[model samples]
Target: MPDDDYDDDRDDETRRPARRRRGPRNNTDVPCPECGARSVRPGPWPWYLGTIGAMVCRAVICEECGHEYDERKPHAHLPTRKRNLAIVINLLGFVGIVSVFVLLGVWIYFTMGRR
Candidate 1:
């Protein structure tokens, strides 16, 4: 590629800065843990997965107090519960199926050889 074609200044205008959303932010006015002030701002989003669900939340930090809090705490226990139930039900079904086969083999062994 040509050197002039890859100019930094030309790409500067094309790359727009990320715009911060305007809204009634939750936990924004919460007091910081470090400074005990309400000058907290939204920080980067934290990604985590738990037994209940996957969690992704923007971190809030107090500018004056230096406290941090999570903004998103989506509950995912319903899906987790359903998944556990499905696994248990499937395991029971497999056990029942294997028992049926075993019973049939025993019955055949007792009846077929005598005849």
Candidate 2:
């Protein structure tokens, strides 16, 4: 029972930071409203997109019947089709600009030789 016999290791110990654990908020096991089959998938975006938008929009789709739904309030659907159309239009615009520059370069190249 001597004070010197106890090592002061308790005071030297560093405090560990508290770890924040995330828990699942919704029950994913719930049956699909459209189809009673458990083949329904949960998450945002379609299954083809790998469900990346699950964080922004909690969406669900029933594979058995091709039914789509969102459980989260104020849910937003992905504008994939619109985005694709925009991309195509932008690409065409870019090609047109480049084509114009190429045409101008060719015109100058030929005209300068004559001058």
Top lDDT hit: 2
Model 2 stretches with alpha carbons more than 4 Å out: 1-78
Encode model 2's per-residue lDDT on 75-104: one tens digit a residue.
334364434544665677799999999999
TM-score of each: 0.34, 0.33
Runs of candidate 1 exceeding 4 Å displacement:
1-76
TM-score computed on alpha carbons, candidate 1: 0.34
lDDT of 1 by residue, 1-115 (tens): 5777777667886897878876533445445455555555765432222322223333565566454554342123334544554566567779999999999999999999896
What is the alpha-carbon lDDT for the whole of candidate 2?
Answer: 0.56
Clash pairs of candidate 1?
40-62
